[model samples]
Target: MPGPPILTSPPKASPGDRVAVLSPSFAAPGFAPAVHEQAMARLADLTGLTPVEYPTTRRLGASARDRAADLNSAFADPEMRAVLATIGGEDQITVVPHLDPTLILSDPKPFLGYSDNTNLLCWLWTHGVAGFYGGSTQVHLGPGPHVDEVHARSLRAALLTGERLEVTDPDESEDVGRDWLDPRALHEFGDREATEPWEWAGPPKSVTGRTWGGCIDVLQWILTAGRFPADPSVLSGGILLLETSEELIPATEFGWIVRSLGERGLLEAVDAVVVARPPASSLEVRPTKQACAAHRQEQRDVAIETIGRYNPDAVVVVGVPFGHTRPQWILPYGGSMTVDGVSRRIWADYA
Candidate 1:
């Protein structure tokens, strides 16, 4: 994959940089503290660095302002090189309204997370601060019993190192969820599924643009709250990313959302779209793999039509694994992305 060309901020990490990990979202540690401990240990092992925590990281029911404050302190601290969100939570939209953009924009660094973390990623872009969209100590750091190589490599590149990351489908994947309370399961890798190759649906072309967009569900929230991005021209040269969450929103509904964004003048704003594999929601969706597969494709088709309806020129690539799923890869929001549709390749460059 070719590295993307956009540069919105200076790289902020070296091999031994001190990175702060905070929970700008919910802290499940109260409900699953062991999982949190395991995740932190795993992150330290993978990065060859120490992990610092905030008072609210594992504190449930923390106010939005409190989370926002922790976020500000993490960014403003001179000793920090990068900031990592533990895991995503619902209602991060709340964090946005109270966010102090000045804290982050002035001293930008690598920021990583997915799911609800979308709120912050979009916020960073709007305020002229670049951030990354993949990698989390809790998810990628704790994939199954062992961290999948794909997630680890991508996380490392996004955080400590800014290099052209290798994008490859995992040979096998697991969708089973274990009780975070099960201490024994913590030592084991989760179940596995054979993975098909990442596919691009149309004729080849390549575009270099800044990375934007996040979990589609969260994008919906931002849109509904009038927090959706301002204009397409601002995103005119950037690669726009869209991924589904575990909620498994239907394809038809997905189309409606994109069409809505188009109505808001969003579709024509991008040069390309990187759509993710729709998350399989129920046991039913998982049992019927073929059906689940079809659901994902249909959703992509709907997205393509929705965007094409508004801007026929927008390029769409399906299946960049990074959101609400296993073997997640890191994405750069407000950073550069290179989509080579001709070669059916995509790469987000942070350095």
Candidate 2:
């Protein structure tokens, strides 16, 4: 297990290049064609890149092998310069084993996704390819009044510009958007609320290192499947990126997961830890505003306290918008990020 120099960022995509818009996990585009089509249009308009779909990109419940074949085709094609997931799903772990690593190695491209897509990102990371951790056309580019400024900027940085950008607070966020079946889902943003300033903890020092980790639930599955490095030291001096999805698991469960990582020698191996603003409500589980605030706060407290118990010197920041939340920042999965505790700011290198 190696670090840093092992995984390299693939060549950035240029304007007019073709990007594979894939649904390797769940065929979200198939369920909501209107939103999906709008997302594709916006993706083209924002980055000046064409969105190319594969055979399984819009075929709901496609077999894992079929999805992998689509992914293989995308990576093998000389015309495809990057790959983006339509949205995250539950069973990408099954899809990863079927992928053709030879094709990915021969023609590595910028792969952007989050949530269950973490499985593929981690797979690529282990194979010496870096990927972007957030970008889902179904969730971010579609269903909103417009593409979020932060999301649009990060999408461009990841796919087209290859520039370093600060990950800033978007000031407002939504736990989950409207149901895809709703006609309003095409243009209206979800119920959004004011966001608190990101909470920072640990020593007042700065650290810049490659990032790993993703949706905590999916990360647990990855660990259970033995997909992570056998040598925890491979993550030494790196940054840990953690976030939760719309399932809205309890704060206690979140603590237990982080505790497991610390027990595995992962906590002390990292120089910094970043936790996304966990989703507190969902379409069928909307809580009152006060309850939502409390849930987020409790999760934040447990993250800081648990990380401190294992590595008090590790710089920790909670509630940066990424992962399942709206206004997400497409951070690098295996690329460099600067977490400055003194200034309380974050910068990601898309190159």
Whose TM-score is greatest here?
2
TM-score of each: 0.91, 0.98
lDDT measured at residue 159 in model 2 versus the true structure, 0 to 100: 94
Give the local distance difference test score of model 1: 0.75
Candidate 2 lDDT at 96 equals: 90
Model 2, 79-147: lDDT tens per residue? 999999999999999999999898989988999999999999999988989999999999999887899
Query: How close to the true structure is residue 57 of candidate 2, measured as C-alpha lDDT?
Result: 90
- Per-residue alpha-carbon lDDT of candidate 1 for residues 1-351, written as tens digits (9 for 90 to 100): 222333367475765668888888877665677777888788878887677888788889999999888888888887788888888888788888877777776777778888899998887777777788877666566535778778888777777777876466666655545656677657765555676566564436788888778988898888778774454566766677888776788898888887877887667777788887667654334547777677877886787777778877767777667776677777778877888878777776766
- Give the Å shift of residue 316 in candidate 1: 1.6
Pairs clashing within candidate 1: 145-188, 145-189, 173-193, 204-342, 205-342, 210-238, 232-269
- lDDT (CA) per prediction: 0.75, 0.94
Highest-lDDT candidate: 2
Q: Which runs in model 2 stand beyond 4 Å of their true positions? A: 1-5
